[model samples]
Target: MFTSMTVINILLSLVFLYFLGKYLLNMYFEGINRPEQWAGKLKQGKITRELQKAQRQYGDKSRFFLFWLQIERIKKEQIQGTFAELGVYKGDSARILHLMEPTRKIHLFDTFEGFIVADLAKEKGEAASYTPTNFSDTSVDEVKRFLGNSDTFVFYKGHFPESAQSLDTEKYAFVNIDVDLYNPTKAGLEYFYPRLSPGGVIIIHDYSYKWEGLVKAVDEFVRGIPENLVLSPDTDGSVLIIKNSVHT
Candidate 1:
C-alpha cells in the first residue's frame, strides 16, 4: 500500500508541473508577442537618452520623441516622404517631425480649441473634459516659436474632414492621427490613407485605449485595411500602421 501511494503522489506532482509549464508558456507568448508590449520594452533609459540628445540638437520638445523613434525606424528600413499629423494639440509632435526631416514639410490639422465640447458631452451623456473655452485659453504662438521662420511646417485650424478635404498634398511618408473620436478617426484614415507614401507609417494615438469610442474606431479601421499593413502597438495606446511598400 505504501509503495502504491508513493507512485500516485509522484504522478500527481508531474501533472501539476505540466499544467504550470503550459500556463507560463501561453502567458509568455500572448504578452511578449504583442507589438505594443514590445514597443514599451524599447522605451528604456538608454533609448530615452538617445532620443533626448536628438531632440536637444534639433528641437527641445517631448512630442519629437515619438516622431524621432518612428522616423529612425523607417530610415533603418530605408523608407521615404513628408510627415503629417492630425490633431496638433500643442504642436510638439509636428515640431519634432520638422526637426528630423527639415527638407520635408510637416502639415498639422487641429481645431486648436481643445475639442468639440458639445459632441463629446452628448457622447458621454455628461460634460466631457474638453471644452470650447479651452482653446480660447491656449495659444499656438509658443508652438510656432519652435519653428522659427521655418516654412516647412503648416497648421490647419478647424474641424477635420472639412479642413482635411481642402488639403492637396499628394503623398506623406509619415502621418500621425490623434483625433480621439470615432468620426474624426474614420475621416482622418479615409483622407490620409490614399495619400500615404509607399512604406509610410500612420501613427494613431489612443487606439485600443480605455476609451470606448477610440477602441471601436481603431478596431473597425484595422479590419478594413489590407493584411500587409502591419499594425504595431505602443505602450501609450498608440498604434503605428506601416503601409507595405508593395501596396501603394
Candidate 2:
C-alpha cells in the first residue's frame, strides 16, 4: 500500500497534469484562431486619438472605440452618405461622429424633453423600471455648443418618424439609434434601414437582455431584412446592422 505522503503527491501530480493539458490545448487552439489584427497592440493614428478623446468625454470607451473602427471600415469600403443619431442625449455621441467625419452632415434627433407614454407602452416587463423622461434636461442649443456649433449638424427637436419626415429622400452612411423604448427603436430601424446606403451601418443601442423591449424591437424589425446583425462586445449593449454592398 502507498504511504499517505506518496498518495498526496500522486494526487497533486494528477491535478498539475490536468491543468497542463488544458493550458496546452488552449494555446494550440488560440494560435490557430488568432485574428488578423492583434489585440495586443494599440490602434494608431487620428481615429485612435479621436476615439480616446470621445471615450474621455462620453465615458463609453468600448462603444466609441467600436464606432471609430466602424467609421474606418466604412471609409475603407468607400460607403457614402450622411450620418445620424436618433437619441442625442447631451450630444456626446453626436460630437464623436462629427469629429470623425466633420464634412458629412450629421442629423441629431431627440425631443430634448424625454420619452413619450405611447412609446414606453411598447416596452416589455415592468414599466416602472424604465425611465420614461430620463433625458429631458438637454436642449438643441446645448447640443450645438457640445458639437462645436457646426452648421453640418442638424437638430430635429421632436418625436422621431414624425421629425424624420423632414429628411426627405436622404440616404445614411452611419446611423446610431439609442431610443431605449420599443416603439421608437423599431420605428428607427424601419426609417433608417431603407435609407441606409449600401455598405452603411446602423448601430442600435441597449439591445442586451437588460432591455428586453429594445431587443424585441430590433428582432421584430430585422426579421425579413437581408442585412446581418452584429452585437457589440461592450456593456453599453449596442448592435450593428450592416447594409450589404452592391459590389459584394
Candidate 3:
C-alpha cells in the first residue's frame, strides 16, 4: 500500500545516509591517521600520489593511512632493502607501495591465475569456501599495464616460495602478505622474516577471525619470532611486524 512517492523518498534517504556515513568515517579516520609530520608534509606537498589515491579511492582509509605512516617511519629510520608483496591480486596495494617510494624496487608475486588448489584446500573461515577461481581474474600483463612503467618493478608470475626461489640473500625493507589463507602466508613469513632487514616491516592482511586459517598462520609464526604483531584498525584487520634492530 506504499505510494511511489514514499518509495522514492525512502531510497533518497538511504542514499543520503550512505554518503553521510562515508563522510563521517573519512573525517574521523583523518584525525587519527594524521601524524605530527602530516601538516608539514601537506604544507610541503610531500605527500605521495599513492597516499592521495588511498584517501580518495580506497574504502579502508584506516588501513591505507597506517601503511603510509609506517612507510614514513621506515624511511625516517633509514631502513635498507627492497619492497615485496606476496599477494598481488590486481596490483592495487603493490602500486600504492611502489608509488610511495618509486626509488625502491618492489617484487610482485602471484599466480596471476588466482589461488592455488593446494593452498586453497587448507583454507578455513571465510576463505575456506573459496576455490582456485576465487581470485583468478587477473594477469601479470594486466597488472603491469595498470601500474604503468615496469621500472623498479619485478613480477614473479607463479606460486610463491617457488616463485621467489630466485631471491637469495637480498634483504627486504617491506613485505606485504595478503594471500588470505594459511599455507602461503606461513610460507611468506618463513621466507621473508630472515631476509627482512633489521627495522624492516611485514604486513599481513586478513588477520581477523573471518580468516581463521590466516589467523592461525600468523599466530604460529609470531610465536617463533622476536617481534610482536601490531594490529591495524583497517577494514580487513591488518597486522604488522617491525623487525628488531638486532635479533635472530
Worst-scoring 10-residue span by lDDT in model 3: 48-57
Candidate 1's TM-score reads 0.66
Q: Could you tally the backbone clashes for each prediction? A: 1, 0, 0
TM-score per model over all chains: 0.66, 0.78, 0.86
For each candidate in turn, give its C-alpha RMSD to the true structure in angstroms. Answer: 13.6, 10.5, 3.2
User: For each candidate, what is the lDDT?
Assistant: 0.67, 0.79, 0.87
Q: Where in model 2 is the C-alpha error above 4 Å?
A: 1-51, 56-58, 125-127
Q: What is the overall TM-score of model 3 with all chains considered together? A: 0.86
Candidate 2, pairs of clashing residues: none
Worst 10 residues of 2 by lDDT: 33-42
By lDDT, the candidates rank as 3, 2, 1
State the lDDT at 64 in candidate 2. 63
